[model samples]
Target: MEKTLKRLSSIRTESDILREFLAEFLGTLTFVCIGCSANAVMLQMPELSLINGPLSWGLALSVSIYVSGGVSGGHLNPAVSLGLASIGKLQWKKLLHYFLGQYLGAFVGSLLAYAIYNQTIDRMPNDITWPIFGTKSASHINAGSAFLDQIISTMFFLMIICSLTDEDNPMKPSKGLLPFAIGFINFGSMIASFSYNCGGALNPARDLMPRIMTAIFGWKSAPFAYNDYNYFWIPIVACHLGGILGCWIYRLMIGNHWK
Candidate 1:
């Protein structure tokens, strides 16, 4: 018992905790900014095309996780953090801090995206151009379809995350594979989902901050139609529910060994 206690205590320290928080903040910020900014740039380029948007996002997330996984477990998405918590991989006490960090990071990232694209936005022929790459609109589906898409996509995303990170997976040789697996998953999911109907933002933080940024910038210039701003809640609530469902489903299939 004494040896076990020592092992537990030795795993982390207060400084480690502080560093994790900072890493989470900066890593998430970098991811959203770079990914969204790339999308914005693509929108201005007639040669780029919409098909490349999702791929760009996938690559951005993959690179960010590769760089940040060592420090904060690479939880740039609030849904991912919540899912991990439900699976007992993350402490409940730190949930609020992680959520706050991710949200703030995303907000800052959006600001950066806006800043970088300000010139392009100003020169755009219309506000509709902004929604082409951002998360504020769903050109591919209607409201009902958008909600459903978010739910299903988030479910799959969380399941993949839980499975890849699972230690019991005999297939998983080492942690080195995690970033690549996660990146590929994101890339595949985006290609499958993102289109005219919303940008397939499987992440609540990714969706919310950009919407908030659009609102702050004024609806006239905002990309989304905003017929019902409350509609945004669907992604927020559904994503969390999807995360919980993913954790439960993984447990059902693989057993509760994750605990």
Candidate 2:
């Protein structure tokens, strides 16, 4: 325990921060690439169900966690980062670096996915393009409900993540199992978001950055056109709020017991 704390605390050097940023960037890139590419392919196919996107995202994120868990704790999602920081697994001072790396990485990943399937997109009509990249609230669901949907989804996700990574938790899984557990529940979370039509975007970087890419590259109104409200803010803002709440809940329910 002492050695682990020492090593974690020792990462205060400039080079270390830069390395951590790069790891986060690359990890997020890997996650968004595989996850969103799968969504794009499925969206273009038309015959497939929406469930496929969540499956792909969950599996892709599992791989992302495996790839980057060692260096940066595999915080491919901003909500995950916020949860970790809230619980003291991450330092608050370096959050800006992590957020920047994650957003940039997500942007690049969205561009890469677009490039890979741009041929089909260019030939396709504009109407179908938005659903491929950005998410929306279901027509029947109001914007407020959609906002709550995101909060609940991210809140559950972060709590599970905190529990899995908590060293003091008896129910915590081994390192190898952590990714799968997170991935599996992430799949569940996406299914939960289906009713709201937010596509279970528990991560701001995952939702907003790609939405930005779509908006800039001709899909100007796609990201915010859902319902009577601009649905873009729901995932980005609500997820952060939910993430903080989740960690606090975990600390209250389980983490504090160690003391």
Candidate 3:
């Protein structure tokens, strides 16, 4: 009994919690930096076609998950965390800690992207490059359209995530494929909607942190900064809602036998 008690106490130490929290922070920071930095570089590369954006983001996200999944569960997105919590897959006590870590990690990642691209950004004329970094403007989209696009894209993304991670599904084959599945979903969503609306940023971390970085870097001079940027919270909120809805839909359709 004493040995068992010692083992349990060792698992619950402050150091263990801190290590997990730091892992979450670093994992999320790396994900955002790689994914969004790729986007920024793609925008600045005159030789490269804009057509490669979706594939680039998908590759980055996939690689990040493969590298970080063991330590942090690879939940680099707030919506993913919320979805897991809603389904009782995550501990409620850790929710806020995870969220704070994700947000701070993303902010750091965006700042790094800004630094890496600072020279290229300065060289480009404001007219040609501002829109690429900034959020979609009201002039670029209506509130209704933006909201619907976010909801639909997030729903699809969440469904794919839940399905891939569902262990009980005999058809799922193995956990080895989850990273590829997630990457493909991101790729599909970006290809299907990024051109029509910039807010198709299905990952809230991908959108909000970059926007915050943009503001900090004085990209607020960019068109639609104040007008459209104010609507940024909608996508964040909608994505969470869509994730919850997607989980419910998955349970209904797939039948949650795979507890």
Candidate 4:
């Protein structure tokens, strides 16, 4: 405990903390903006959605990480930040700072996307535009199943991330290529599962903050009222659970075995 405190103290200089905050903020903002813009584009081009949605999101994340990784380890997602903290890879003292940046960034990103696409959005129906900002469970699934699906999706994502960055893992990608590799994971995950369930919101910030924007803009009750409000909270709660679970499983099965 004493050693942990000392380590945290040594790194908690004001400048360092501020840099981390800004890095997370900018990284998340870039990611959400690009991803949402893609959604907006897909809104105009429905036939190409199968090829566009996952690919755009994947590239957005890759670029964001490349931009922020040097300064802050590029944890653009609150789920990733919390998961790393749970495993002691991130100091708990910095978690709130990270969360503040991530959430605010997401909100701003959503606002930016809306600003750019409002003209188009205005012409479309609210039901069509809302999914670009937030997520909705598919008609076949209830809130419970959606919740479980998110947990599993995020769990798998976090597990792969943990493995990719594990210092002791023999198969980890080179540092320069890690972001793209992670991006591909996201792309593949989205292709396989993002559409089938709750639109693949592996990150809460990606969903909740934008959802708030939609509510305030013109979406009103629909974003929250969809699925009787039961589905609105699933990604936020389940992803955190999934992150911790993923890290724990990795630690038990692989991390602990590293010599």
Candidate 5:
């Protein structure tokens, strides 16, 4: 009876869940708002993206992680949340809270970006502006190739993320630098694949939510109907699988080897 009562007492309450939800929400919002703002800027000046896109997204992720890492571990992306949960690092029950927070936060963040750039957005062509809110495959790639691209890229991303945050890893960064280190991983990823099959959307919430916003806010169904809707689901579905596989691979290769 004493053990049962102690366990019950230690269980997270509704308030704890709420706090985590709010942290994830705010963190994701910060990430999307800042990252998409950079995308918006690059729409007007395409040449700038070669430098601006990677740097802005990396710093944006770093800042967002710093903002909410204390409260919720700053799994600002659903892929990160799913990966951690799969590895038993996060409670399965908390997946709903994290998903809701991340998706809602991403949607609201897109709205904020829209509010800030509506005038310029209205003047830009749809093709130019839509990518600001969502990813589109480069014409050379088909849906199958794009799907594989997301899987491979996101798999690599989550593998590194698990390494960076693993407490048992000998070379893990200090807590203070973890955010920046993870941010640079993202930066390096973008530099390598930002123009790849689907712009390397490693986070489902980051891609899908903002893509939905583009559909609603004047881009219409073209955002979803692109490539006969075949391309639309690649980022969402592939990232989840990639995240899970990445965590599994990390545990198999490095995490399980830790003493």
Candidate 6:
């Protein structure tokens, strides 16, 4: 009887963990659904998206975090989770769970967005250089500039994220407001970087899964190439490095000072 009770308790604990993972999956899905779909609308109808793109994405992200923050810390982006883990604020063991949830969520979320906007996509001009579901560099920015943009912007992103969540910081935001602060920072980053063809893809799952969706939809290898250069690797590699760098910088500046 005692052993059976212990087994039942363990099962309940496992069930709770699964629920947390489900929360992350649903949160990320909602996050990318809004972000990617907004970009899709911009691609098809720039007029409608011009004013709403950055703001809507930021607000959607805030909502995602608010919905799942208590259960999973609402790490809808892999880079954010990795950054926190690199700083010892998040357990490395939990990374696999978070990543799996985020990637799958982003994948399905983007697909859902595509389903909503396929009509507009079909009507795009052949000259329509805007991305459908994947990121592409703008003409003014070459591969090098685009890569630099992602790396540096991601550094700023993770730095702010870490600072906001830093326990040692005297001005940490209350739980209710942290998501808004993050959303504002994300909006600021987009306003600053999106014009440069950086695509403002701070998360690999956000970039790659949608790209995969495009590929599945028959865009083929084009989503991975821009300016006759294969740039698929830039955002993924740079953001991870940026996260590590941000964690290092934060540790040097504040985390290391903690007793």
lDDT tens per residue, model 5, 1-259:
9999999989775697998999999999999999899999998888998878888888999999999999999999888889889999899999999999999999999889989999999996886788898888887789889988888888889999999888898899999999999999899865346546687688999999999999888999888887788888999999999999999899999999976
* Of 2 and 3, the candidate ranking higher by TM-score: 2
Off by over 4 Å in 3: 1-16, 46-50, 125-134, 137-140, 189-195, 221-230, 257-259
Compared with the true structure, model 3 gives a TM-score of: 0.83
lDDT of 1: 0.73
Instruction: Indicate whether candidate 1 or candidate 6 has the larger TM-score.
Output: 6
User: lDDT tens digits, residues 132-174, model 6?
Assistant: 5556667777778878877787888888888889878888899
What local lDDT score does residue 252 receive in model 6, on the 0 to 100 scale? 89
**Tens digits of lDDT, candidate 4, 1-259:** 9999999879755688899999999999999999999999998999878878999999999999999899888889988989989999999999998998899999999899999999999998887789998878998898889989988888888899999999999999998999999889899865346557778899999999999999999999888888878898998999999988888889889999987
Cα lDDT for residue 159, candidate 2: 85
For candidate 4, give the lDDT of residue 142: 89
The best candidate by lDDT is 4
Deviation of model 5 at 132, angstroms: 0.5
Local distance difference test, per candidate? 0.73, 0.81, 0.69, 0.90, 0.89, 0.79
Residue range 1-259, candidate 1, lDDT tens digits? 9999999988865775676777777878888888878777777674775556666777778788877789889888888888889878899888877788788888888888888788777676545555533464444456777777677777788887777777787666368878777877787765445534555777888777776776677545344455456356766777777777877788778756544
Q: How accurate is candidate 5 locally (lDDT)?
A: 0.89
lDDT pick, better of 3 and 4 = 4
Query: Can you rank all candidates by TM-score, best first?
Result: 4, 5, 2, 6, 1, 3
Candidate 2 local lDDT, residue 140: 74
By TM-score, how accurate is candidate 5? 0.92
